[model samples]
Target: MGIHIIKMPDLGEGIAEVEVVEWRVKPGDTVKEDQVLADVMTDKATVEIPSPVNGTVIALGGEIGESLAVGAELIRLEVAGSGNQNGKTATPATATATAGTTLPGSPVSTVCERAEELEEAPAPVAKAAPAQAPLLKAAPPRARGLAAPAVRQRALELGIALEFLEGSGPEGRITHADLDAQLLRRVKVAPSGPKPSDPTDAERTIAVTGMRRKIAQKMQEAKRRIPHFTYVEEVDVTELEALRAHLNGQHGNQRGRITLLPLLMRAIVLSLKQFPQANARFNDESGIVTQYDAVHIGVATQTAAGLMVPVVRNAHKHDLWSSALEVARLAEAARAGKAVRDELSGSTITITSLGALGGIVTTPVINHPEVAIIGVNKMVERPMIRDGAIVARKMMNLSSSFDHRVIDGMVAAQFVQTIRAYLETPATLFID
Candidate 1:
């Protein structure tokens, strides 16, 4: 019956204008309310903006790789209900159930208010005017990869220009690794940080773009907006390792590569069964804590593109092998860039791992809404003193970070300990 304007919502901190990476709908296409219509690339994350109003698309603001400010008119829509009078636009205050389905609005974006605060403050003076001279090539928005904001700022500090370099990231954004490789050309050793190079001076350029960039933004919002606390415990995965090996040997690599992941996941699910209080999300605006009945554990995998936390949706629905199968499928899809839109989001809880790169311990960011994250590290063969004798054992560290506003310190510690019990005993996972 009438047309409506959907403005771009702010993505996150320090995010200015985002480049329209791709538009999902064209003019005259009917879209459902809350259906994703475009992918916007910020300095931090690739945001999928949904249609707020169910209607027919009338016009898209721009084509791919075009930048638009937050609050800009992104899409015009023609709704199905309400009468138009005097040739003016009109829409039903109440949605028509027959035409389209609208999901409840997701938690008030934690980043929106923060972005408003930043905008209301004083503006900075112009640093310098653009160069009129020619010959310097500028890389289009698509050329760079997934470096974090910190990494990009570091690159700028080192006097490295982003436009010249080739990106090894998803959608071709420059990454910290690409920068490190350049630095490697100059120095024998690489320094350390998120951007490689430890206690050294050689530097290079890194551009932040795509999902990994988004991961950084979400983590920041989680850290700032949500009150979080950590609870850590040393888990003896010795028995769990034997069980995993036996299962893998029986199934072999083709059927599925049995690893501690499924065992840990199974244990995590069972513990959630016991302690339902731990399985919850904090609603910041409503001042309520929402607990979930299903276990949708998000596994945090780091690909060459960036860190992706794909959910094993309804993880509790599957058996041990089925759980393994689902985990493998999601992980493989993520690494291959075959992950569907929904496959990457809507997690109730999460687990993050650094594979062989993980050290003795590291605190991971709590995936927002999910309230908690389980972090896994490298298995080290170390000397263990038991029964008055020292013996070598392969052991790994598990660290869990929780939103303190929802879960208290003691409950979190106990939750990890409960999971440790199943992992340490191993048979507890199989026993009814």
Candidate 2:
């Protein structure tokens, strides 16, 4: 019998420390090799630390929200095997499993490398600092009404004045659904709202911590450091919609139902082939821009755990049906907070949509380091002029933001125009 110490492996380039968000196993719990032990959040994504050998957990490194340096002792295990006595930790197989049971909507991947791997890895090449503080909107007062602690916390974060909120939980306790309803109601507005006022006597103050804090920091950094230029354009999707319905009808029950996103994604990938500048990343520190051959599209999805963007890798390689299925799979996993870390990173370009709720003209901020982000707006049926005649057609808007330092105005306009052309003519997507 021997004891093995599992240290936090190098999470990624330049990430020297991480926060322990959750622990899966406790002392005296017997765990198997490759089983998840803890969830650690890094700058990029949340990663799952898997146990290296089958053993009984004797101790944990830290509590939730505790930050630990990489290579620090994470877990102490008593094993019933040999070859681990030399202080060498075994690496899991190349097949890494995703654990969504802990935090849904967040990617969780097993750490499969050894300490030496961390040493051999090169330092992170580029660093982008936050340009300014995040501009947060006002949240509502604390509900003096009956509600669970979790419900109350969510209400405060969303700035919902919950004093008048109706409760659906047992004994009139407030529920998560109720809070969501309040949030959606507030989101539907004619213009951007004002900043939230200071807490009132009726409001309960909730501390900003965990993932919420991280999101605020990143957004601020991107907005302040990068000079953003937004361009908005409208596209006619009547034929595209018809073709989508026809394709879905043909697919029948053989595959997942197709959504407008995959069609839009296919169009974007084809457009990137013509304008690669939009599909690249810029390093502010080095003043260098790196273009990628592979198209990894980040789909910004809203979930119960704030907003999470999961990447659809090698998107250009998949067909319409396959792209639809991949989008659905990645979205579902993200919604459930079960996406893996790899699924959340390495997006050269991003596409954000509100689905049916997509409104008109959103100037989405560019995900830092990445040069561009494409926004999808709500599709509306309106009167149009065609063939010297007025008729009703389904129309939508494509709103995009670019890093002005990397992409010029002409290039950005041309890039979006190309996407407009592909979407206007649905058949063009099928061709090489």
TM-score of each: 0.58, 0.67
Measured over all alpha carbons after superposition, the RMSD of each candidate to the real structure, in angstroms, is 17.7, 19.3
Give the TM-score comparing model 1 with the true structure, all chains together.
0.58
> Residue by residue across 58-97, what tens digits does model 2's lDDT show?
6776656555667866887778865245533332210111
The reply for model 2, stretches above 4 Å from the true place, is 1-5, 25-35, 51-60, 75-200
Residue 329 deviation, candidate 2, in Å?
1.9
Candidate 1 weakest ten by summed lDDT: 89-98
For all candidates in order, the CA lDDT equals 0.73, 0.79
Error of 2 at 414 (Å): 1.7
Q: Write the per-residue lDDT of candidate 1 for residues 1-432, one digit (tens) a residue.
A: 665778778876556567676799987689998999998866423568998778887677654644566776677777766512222422322122113542333123335666788899998887765686567687665644345565586477666777777764435556555665556555655556566456585455544445545666577668777777766677767667777888788886667777778888888989998778777888897888888899888898777678887789898877777888888888888787667657777788898888889887888888887788898888887889879999877788887888887788888888898998888898888765
Clash count, one per candidate: 15, 13
